[model samples]
Target: MSKISFEGIGEVAATFACEAEVQAGQVVGLTGDGTVGPCESGGRICGVALSSEDGYAAVQIGGLCRVAKTGEEVTPGFAKLSADGTGGMKKDEAGGTEYLVLRVESDGMVIRL
Candidate 1:
């Protein structure tokens, strides 16, 4: 059997139409209409919005990005994170996606997607 493994090269970002108003630095998810919008609690995260302009947003899909927290203290290290339902991230103990948390600051935490 042939084996193959895929790894992301580097930071990846893409532009997408917004389903609704999205601010920069907010975590977004794919909407039913194929547009991007603020991710709801426990929703599958698509990427972090780097900029929002003209009904569109530039989202970072890979590599390190800063994300707002849901006021829950999370120790810096490896942990699972999920949407906070209001454009922020939270420590998900209930089988969420895992990411490497590089640092925890008062504003937000740096995570490698």
Candidate 2:
């Protein structure tokens, strides 16, 4: 997929090789091999996958991006987010990186990474 960029929303995305199949909107992280893959629980988030084909994926690394969520409730505000181990996001009270959640949609939340 091509890199995604928006005029004023500050969206930043880049293409990367994937270790395995990654669906769009799934949270992903850098693997030990430096390839991107679905993030595991507590894994450091690299970005949200915008598109995936073959062994490459377009990952949104910065700015507002929509992503799936776990059963845990998330609201609009600043909150720590981490992978749910199955390509979804969950609130991370344990703390580390904090992302700004702009809105909670029926499908997912819009967050600024």
Candidate 3:
């Protein structure tokens, strides 16, 4: 038999219309335009999804979860942000300012909100 390849992805807690393409394990947030995309500063987060899609996608919006890492190692207490204002988590910028991190994980990272 010829070698074959496939992709397996799951759904999330809640389903919402996506303003942009969202990937599994990516940090998602609500945009000012009232659509779910990627988490960014000064924006509200929904949560991480289980799969990647363009239009309508499932969002978790709560609880401990696994998110995509944005080239940054996150510990139990590290703060995170949406990578490039889209999916994926990255370490918050330098500063002890508030609103540093949206979700803090004990082992991994919880989704958006």
- CA deviation > 4 Å runs, candidate 3: 1-12, 32-34, 39-44, 52-54, 78-86, 93-113
**What is each predicted model's overall lDDT from 0 to 1?**
0.82, 0.80, 0.53
Candidate 2 differs from the real structure by a C-alpha RMSD in angstroms, to one decimal, of 5.1
Kindly list the per-residue Cα lDDT of model 2 for residues 1-113, writing each as its tens digit.
22543222788899999876688878999985647998878877999888899999998888877778876788889988888888878888895478888777666777888
Residue-wise lDDT of candidate 1 within 11-101, one digit each (tens)?
A: 7999899866789989999885657998889877999988898888888899877788875688878988899988888998885798888
Clashes of 2: 0
Root-mean-square deviation of candidate 3: 8.5
- Which residue pairs of candidate 1 clash? none
Q: Estimated TM-score per prediction?
A: 0.84, 0.84, 0.53
Supply candidate 2's per-residue lDDT for 112. 85
TM-score, cand. 1 vs. native = 0.84
Q: What lDDT score goes with residue 72 in model 1?
A: 66
Ranking by lDDT: 1, 2, 3
Q: State the weakest 10-residue window (summed lDDT) of model 3.
A: 1-10
Overlapping backbone residue pairs in candidate 3 total 4
Best by lDDT: 1
